[model samples]
Target: MGPDTRARATSESPAGREQGQEYDASPYLPRRGGLAALRRASADCRGCPLFQDATQTVFGTGSPTARLFLVGEQPGDQEDRQGEPFVGPAGRLLRRALAEAGLGDEEVYVTNAVKHFKFTTAPRGKRRIHKAPSLREMSACRPWLAAELRLVSPRLVVVLGGTAGKALLGNSFRVGEERGILRPMPSLEEGEGEGGGLLLATVHPSAVLRADDREAAFRGLVADLSVAASALD
Candidate 1:
């Protein structure tokens, strides 16, 4: 599909989609092997239309055996350019928060619910801004995440935003109402497979960057993540 068609498709409201609709990612999954193989296979994935204009598939990066798996929304402009996740301003903030909460890079495995960067250009054509991934796009890419969760089998899955939370949990999940709490991973349908051991919801680091009080928001994020850190004890 062309850019305009893809944009229009993804711009549809969540309510516009029919109930119980599913997007399949199984065809994009690696036939055999682990994370390395999966990451390589993902680069060529055309599971959704988002890949058409995306710079490249931004796969998960971090320890293969880390006990904590962190899921974010999608790659920002910087990450899209750099071909990695969590390397932009929001990413810097996340790293800082992790440090404050006493968790190092080695302790976490980071990835996004959506592997592709979805964006729209400014009228002036100088800037590209993030566009939230539609539910269909998220669902189309979920199998990769489910595969990661299965491979890593972390003790805790830390959801960093509403997108990631809703993708893993459900549409009814609200980060504001449920942040910082640990919930069991609900069983999935016959084919969907389990995600994480225990799920913890929290605001995305980018939310702090956009907040009125950056300090307070940063601290709150750190506090929420600290709970995940403390869970290790």
Candidate 2:
């Protein structure tokens, strides 16, 4: 990572104030290793309070040479328990969507903006309801995602949902406004120049599952993903 990128990763955000001290995963990142080293190091991360409650840190998974990258908001109930990103119902939906969009499973790398699962317990059952990570939390955990970006260096990044979008593109990102448009990826200082690669934003698969018109929502997701597929051609 370049000095500027490193500086952003270590910088304090609001979550730091809430914790009464600065917090970020940057400190735990391996200064001299690849994805394997990063995954091992992340297991011990105490960068944010979310780790205190999460079962484990879910790191990105795929070959380093994958041409496509997919970033989601964070882990859901099933994903947290499984120690992998996108393994729940939403993940299943995503996999199907990718197939429909003509992107093979082996072509993509999958991960999340935040590695930990943030949630609140249900009052009646032992169920853990999903809670969206605050921007502060997203900022705190960004270095891991940044590192993944540096390593995978995919030709196109499909950002699923607003959280992942904001993590990559900043606060102004909106899925409704940005979905399906291919544009230059912002420089992460490790891969791709200013005009290299492309980023496309879309709603989270969970949102499609939650929609009243499930089929329509799923089709919309497929449509957006097809745009990404076309770009690779």
Candidate 3:
């Protein structure tokens, strides 16, 4: 079925939010479709106000059947303009770390907890500064992530930051406390069937970029990812 038709099939009511209600993306999700259908439907999503300022919805990319799924916090300025996740400086670092951890490109799928970029503008120039998405925004955008997890059913998921970890695991997830260990995946919702996969949390590559000890941080990220890679063996 087509994306629009599939989206309509999933929801009986029109897509909108009532006053005083939190924004939700579930109505925009397709009842039955693959990644392509989900991607197309997401383009028209008004699930949250973040869409207003973003250039476009940055959806996950990589083989649908990839065994290793990588989740980041959200798209950055470069990802916002390009409409692709992990193409910026941090992405470069992540690519290197993945290689160091022995994870090939072909085995990995990458996405973010939130599809839109939330930012603040600088006073001097038109430079946009990254702002972390509020927990409400993360909650609003979660249906997409849940759908992806349900479809992919990956053997392993490498969470690249606390935000992605919290979005997938729970608000109580702490990367520092939980990094470098494989654990069972949590269901995004009741009866979602998202369990059974292995999950590993780690510092986002952006953290390595901003770190005082860059070499150490990058090594730590690679080490955490290495644990994920070994689990797929």
Best by TM-score: 3
> Ten residues in a row with the worst lDDT in model 1?
10-19
| Model 1: per-residue Cα lDDT at residue 81 | 89
Poorly placed runs, candidate 2 (over 4 Å): 1-19, 189-195
Local distance difference test, each candidate: 0.84, 0.86, 0.87
Which digits, one per residue and each the tens of the lDDT, describe model 3 over residues 1-233?
36575445334323233444676888789878899999998887777777767888999998789899999999999999999999999999999999998885547789999999999999999999999998988998999998988788899988999999999988999999999988888888876655877888999999999999999999999889888878888
User: What are the per-residue Cα lDDT tens digits for candidate 2 across 65-164?
Assistant: 8889999999999999999989899999999999999886547899999999999999998999999998878988999998998888899999999999
lDDT of 1 by residue, 16-92 (tens): 24444455566768778999999998886766767767888999988889888899999999998899999999999
Point out the higher-scoring one by TM-score: 1 or 3.
3
